[model samples]
Target: MVSQSAFAFICCLSLLLTFAHCKTLKRDVKALNEIKASLGWRVVFAWVGDDPCGDGDLPPWSGVTCSSQGDYRVVTELELYAVSIVGPFPTAVTNLLDLTRLDLHNNKLTCPIPTEIGRLKRLRTLNLRWNKLQDVIPPEIGELKRLTNLYLSFNNFKWEIPKELANLPELRYLYLHENRFTGKIPAELGNLPNLRHLDVSNNHLVGTIRELIRVEGSFPSLRNLYLNNNYLTGGIPAQLANLTNLEILYLSYNKLSGTIPSGLVHISKLTYLYLTNTSKALGLMERARLSLFKHFPYQAEYHLVPYLGRPLLRTNHSATLPHLTSSRPNMWRFSLWRFFTR
Candidate 1:
């Protein structure tokens, strides 16, 4: 009788939970419709937990995640990439008090992003790239205190980057390339404690690029930086050399003038380089001083087969060299080469 009573009690609790879950789902769907209407012609195949009347698996529906017991109170993540969705940023997501991640990248999303997005307290990754988003980035975005990866590239966004972004204590990767953003890079941007990759290229931004290199004192975790195709007109910032982990650099198609910063001589870890069409002289920026391979005690050797066709450096020099610089089938015919070999 005790076991039977316990089973009946558990069954009663489950029924109550199902009722509560259905109620929450109805509320969430009502909220989503507001966003969908603003989207107009844009359509997304999004799954938010499940349609309360869904015929299949209830939990794994398009943009929906569920609680362990299949309840509806917990909303975990929203990844809506490449969905071809259009129109303004959705503000109804604020109602999902428990949503952790929100991604709507590679879509046709338009209009200024809603400032209410800061409500996603647990949001860790927010990707809104490859959209038609315009206007100045809202400062309220800094309120997503837990953000890690932020992708806002390929849009018509303009004006100064919001300095309030420095408030994000855990921000890591930020990609804002190919936009209409103008003005100097914010000084406070250097204060982001965990910033790693920053790509703000292909914009109309003007002014010096120094503050972004070592804004406060150092850039311990920064790696890749792409600021090409802009109106940045000045000497390369010397502090940029302090970024030891920098591997890839693209500064082409800018109005930047003056010689490359001498500090670049010490950046030996760089593997990819693109510094063409700038007012800065090219010859001076070719080489970087590296820890001598021989002196580095037992360093691992990463050998590459000789690349004789094109210079590994991505420069304006690719056209000048014959197909192969080291040797060509025609080079053997020279009498001077035969005599030197003998």
Candidate 2:
């Protein structure tokens, strides 16, 4: 029953496997240690010891997430969100080459995002929102070909929104709102076929909204588009009606002029259309038509009512149109209720 030769061979193979495992584990441990040190290790005291990946299914560190890769486990995610970790962008993350999700949102991290972030080619979700980080976004971020969700909102980031972001073919959600970002929205962004939610609202953006319509099937899958509280000018594009899946459209507090596109009513899925205080130039007749659509599903807020210092449709007065008077009394009440409440 005791075959020394086979037993020795098995033992040797086991040692080799252990060695390989240690090599991979050590690399991740070193990187994590560096991150802890950079962010002040006292804050992440739970990240103690040399094995951040832990012994079995659980990780030794608080925010570390690992997955088995052959004989060894590798760190795949590091969610240190809202942990009060302060300092510059933790450059040590670049060392975790296998990391797929890096969420450090709501931190006190400062300085520009490191270009070394590009090395994490496997990153899918990078959530750095609500941080104190500043400076322009690194163009190297476009190197993350597999990225899907990128949230850099509510930061102090300035300069033009990076056109390089168009390189992410897999991107779905991109939030860069409430930043100091200026310049026109990148026309290249409209080319992303799978992008579903894009919010660049409350920035200093200017120029015509036409940049987004440069591509034929622009924002083909977009659902919620927020471009409000900016200095954007020119008419609302009729092509926007092509976003048949769009549900919430916010174009308020801008200098947009010209007739409200009639094609907008055709977007049957649209539920919320916010055009409050857009421009005084919008035709009163056109505004009245938008407010009175019988089939319009959700509340629509136009600049026509109180902002223009008069009621758009005075159903009680002689000024009420023949069409308005002839309409079912219930339909008129319903339309007025939705318009005024908004």
Candidate 3:
């Protein structure tokens, strides 16, 4: 009795598999309605109509996340930071081929950043910081080799600093500070051996911090090297005491000169040393008999105290201070909790 041509051949194979699952959920709802009409459609994209990946009764759109795949959905994650999405940066958001996290940092975004965004090869974390993004950082974003954390700070980018970001072999936190960038600084970013916190401080970068620590193993897991207020001059590079896991060394207001390098105060992991705004343009004297605290190998390491002036007169009161005044003890104003409690 059930042979009406085998139930009309199982109803034409369940209507051709539900018309190919509504044609892959209507092509991920037409690429999320072309990124909500290229980021101009507000009212939170009007609840992105027509069942956007939340069918069991419909819910998903707003900041759009969607998941499933074989059954439908798609658009992985589009955070949309700061709401007020103005325009420009929406190159149809690389058409959501399973986007991995494209947070459009602090909106009001202007132009530039579209070198087709290195086609987002599953981008890791690319927050376009404080937008208004001007030209030149797209050396195809080093083709996002699964980028780690690239926040283009303050924006209005002026170019230069892109030595193809050393092909991002898993880049770790690279914020291009205060943008208006100029030349030098790119000693291939010390070949990014998993760079850790490298801020190109206050740009107008001039060079000669010996291309940043003369490049040996270079920034080997660097811990916070800001290169303060650029226009940088010479003389702080005793290979920066080879950044022995440096801990906060800003190099304040640049135009740096000599002295301060007694192997950089024995970098037993310095705790905040800004080089006293370059001791009044390196007039840092006291080298006649060469004893920057006898290169501290320990004599209780000169009673370790001065961070802003007071305790360091113990080589038996080191001949009663005053070798070049400026009120002595300015080992660049210490006190970063006395180098992590001794």
**Judged by lDDT, which candidate is best?**
2
lDDT (tens digit, per residue) of candidate 1 on 106-192: 888889988888777778888888899989899999998988988898988999888887888898998988888889777677777
lDDT on C-alpha atoms for all candidate structures: 0.64, 0.78, 0.69
Q: Tell me the TM-score of model 1.
A: 0.70
**Lowest summed-lDDT stretch of 10 residues in model 1?**
333-342
Model 2, runs deviating above 4 Å? 1-24, 55-59, 285-304, 308-342
Off by over 4 Å in 3: 1-28, 31-70, 73-87, 91-98, 101-123, 127-148, 157-171, 178-195, 203-221, 230-244, 247-265, 268-279, 283-342
Better of 1 and 2 by TM-score: 2
By TM-score, the best candidate is 2
C-alpha TM-score for every candidate: 0.70, 0.81, 0.34
Please list all clashing residue pairs in model 1, or write none if there are none. 47-62, 47-63, 47-64, 48-63, 49-64, 265-289
Question: Candidate 2: RMSD over Cα atoms?
Answer: 7.3
RMSD of 3: 17.7
